[model samples]
Target: MPLNKKLAEKLNKRFAPDSRLDDTYQGLDLTYITNELGEPITLFIGKRRPDGAITGERYVRTIKRVPNSDQIASSHWDLKGKVSRS
Candidate 1:
């Protein structure tokens, strides 16, 4: 996937190598899919195990752009599949 340059710049501060936007955690890795306009639309969240295996969770994270601005007013994360405890 191509990098979202505009969003990345806003997500990190000068001199900061890390992204302010949430991506990964102790055992989970996240990948994103963007639209033609370079906006993130889909997310693939994977959970890593000690046995070198991974489990995945698909989600939709929609960004609401602020009217007449380059800023995102808000965003929402919604799980894609049926909800259940494993």
Candidate 2:
């Protein structure tokens, strides 16, 4: 199944990115993570097409976290040919 609106909203709030759709995978397929409990987790934003289409299948390549990592006030995203960290 494809990512849904509720899950997308949750990821959006967590990242609260200036733009929600900014990558290239979601359009082609679904990407995601499942927690230890086996629940799906979204670690990145969706992709936005030039035509203004918002898709929930996109994702980040290396979603990692370190304790006390350089205090990022907000989540981030970057796309340079491929989606990556900001």
Candidate 3:
């Protein structure tokens, strides 16, 4: 399922300073989904077409909350080995 309104907005603001979303991915067409445990995961990242459809690279990163804070942060989120579309 897609992220909820509040959560989506929070994530967008948190990831706003991410340069990789532009320099590396070439665009900010990212989608965030949470797992059963409510942990945010970045499932897709790519470019958004004129029609507002996102199409591109897929990722699998389990985001975690920062120690002593409510803020979530990713560590070594860079794409690594084969990431199957599944």
lDDT of 3 by residue, 35-86 (tens): 5444434545556556544466554554567898766665323343333233
List the candidate numbers ranked by TM-score, top first.
1, 3, 2
Inter-residue clash pairs, candidate 3: none
Query: Residue by residue across 38-71, what tens digits does model 1's lDDT show?
Result: 5556655576445433357666766788899857
**Candidate 2, 1-86: lDDT as tens digits:** 33455544444433322323333333443344444323334344455445555343344422445566732244333332344333
- Per-model C-alpha RMSD: 9.5, 11.8, 10.2
Alpha-carbon shift of residue 3 in model 2 (angstroms): 7.4
Candidate 1's TM-score: 0.47
Best candidate, TM-score-wise?
A: 1
Q: Clashes in model 1: which pairs?
A: none
When 1 and 2 are scored with TM-score, the better candidate is 1
